[model samples]
Target: MALELIKGNTAVAEAAMRAGLVSYFGYPITPQTELLEHLSARMPELGRAFVQAESELGAINMVYGAACTGLRTMTSSSSPGVSLMQEGISYISGTELPAVIVDVVRGGPGLGNIAPSQADYTQIVHGGGHGEYHLIVLAPASVQEAVDLTGMAFDLAEKYRMVVCLLLDGFLGQMMEPVVMPDFQPVRTTPPEWAVGSPDSKERVVLTSINIDPPNQEQFNVKMMTRWEEVEKNEVRYKGYYLDDAEYVVIGYGTAGRIALTAVRAAREQGHKIGLLRPISLSPFPTRAVDELADRVKGFLVVEMSNGQMLDDVVSIAARRVPVDFYGRMGGMVPYPDEIANAIIEMIQGEHDVNADGRAKWLAKMRELVGTGE
Candidate 1:
């Protein structure tokens, strides 16, 4: 495979096509509009279904409809647009329809900015919509990763019969990097038996999120939970760097993780014992790996582009056994590697009281940085 300089969004779009994506429906949103644009030209030329939806709501529902027919389908949008698609996402989850959603997150509380940010960490990973469902969220840190994971998203979605979100920040989406595209797979023309229209089927197939019967719905929920557990057990993915003898660790994902890697390398070169734990699968979250490292490391620092959204997960996995600190730059601010290195150094040199007081102090310091404390 020849390497080509490709933008992250373009890489993702092309990767989806190679993965046999038969249908694509999306509305343009910044940092992600190029993905839809690429698909707009390519999908039509390939005779695949492509639609420039009226709105995000329409796009997601279109995904739902296509997915019901057992076609590999996907939709992409930015943060605000993603918010509008939550209801449809929830519905897709409830029905156990397989589909891919790419969230090229920008700064946001509500239409905050068009720059890169990981603010949607909690929203996409922790369930953006009303439900007990979980999205198999994959956070790619590079353009190559964006390409690889976008291709994998289709397989995972079908394998688990669940929604898969390729969560990337705007920086990753817009940035260009050398990527070797994956080889194409042949598209499946035969619809699965569970699909709405099966030519060999003698009976009609209906897909719906609603189950009026209380006991039946309860049973359905149990089945969903069981499947989720299976996903958690088998699908957790992450990358650990310099953990063998490191006294301090930094945790992050996506663009934040990519930045943290640079910081970790620099800190290592400076004789500061720092390492990185980067989660590739955000939902399963590499909990076991974190727990194992927690026993070895002196303390942990969570770096993100949001107000410690992923920090909560890191803390929980650490289980208060080690002191955990958080540093983030919200609303489109990207942290420099030096700044993150400094944060890690401070964490290592600061108090080691994993007690309530130490935790409180750490929170206080973080709050001060964000100007949320008095």
Candidate 2:
């Protein structure tokens, strides 16, 4: 198949259209602005609905309405813009609305900058809104990855009857690379039997999470937990590099993982045994994969562009079975491969203290949460 060089944001928009999204509602934000612009110019020719919503909140609600009518819908934004959509995302999760959200992340505590950052990992995977629900978050490390994952996200969203988030960073969104888009298709949707407002309302039903009864809320939590377990069982996804006989592993996701690969290569050349564990699905988290590596590796160094949010999972998974250390560069800063290589070398050489006890306590807590308490 022939490939065309395209920017990540443009590739994502093209892939979304090729995947047959008929309704798009979004507010433009840096890094992802090109995607919306592309869609705005092209979707009309395909007879689709594309709205530059008044606000992120309005955009998400528009998606909710379109999704309720059984259309494949999408929205794109950066970190601060995404924050505004949280309430709508939460509501959609409670109602099990099938939609795809693209977050080309920029730095943030609040509108920090328009540079790439993985600071939103905690928010995306651990529920950014006021609920006990999880979005299936996919981290794309490159332009092609961004495109491919966008298509996969829409499919998974419909199949699971859930919200799916494509978590990319500004670097990936702006970088240009060759990609082969899938053949275009007309939009087709089969509303879940449980979807609300169908003509056969007496036979089917509408359900929301706004439970007034205490038992009902408890039941909702239990039900959502069950769904999450099912997701972990079937959907935890990751990629490993240079892991054979390594004494230490470097863990990362999204664009950070792409940069970490360079460190892995350099470390290997220096005769330092280091591996990379890159999780594609942040929500399901690829926990078991990390656990398997934990039994083999002596230690792990988690590197990210945030204040160690994902490092928590690495610590919990490795437990006392191995040492775990964290390193990060926040506020849109990205660590160079040399820096990461040095960190891995330090971890393996025992130059820095690794938290075995903290890892042990975290493991116990995770075990309790997952009902596998040891």
TM-score of each: 0.96, 0.91
**Index of the highest-TM-score prediction:** 1
Alpha-carbon runs more than 4 Å astray in model 1: 356-374
Full-model lDDT for every candidate: 0.91, 0.84
Q: Model 2: which residue pairs collide? A: none
Across 1-374, the per-residue lDDT of candidate 2 in tens digits comes to: 89999999999999999999988999989989999999999889888899999999999999988777666899999999999999999998888778999998888898699998888888888888996888999998888888888889998888777899999988899999998878886677545456565654458665565788989888987887898789889988889998888788899898788888999999899888788989999888988888998887788888788878898888777776787876676778787888778777767876434445433433454355445534
- Give the clashing residue pairs of candidate 1, or none: none
| Candidate 1 per-residue lDDT over residues 172-240, each given as its tens digit | 999999999999899976779898887866688989999899899999999999998999999999998
lDDT of 2 at 147: 84
The alpha-carbon deviation from the true structure for residue 277 of candidate 1, after best TM-score superposition, in angstroms, is 0.4
Error of 2 at 285 (Å): 0.5
lDDT of 2 at 52: 100
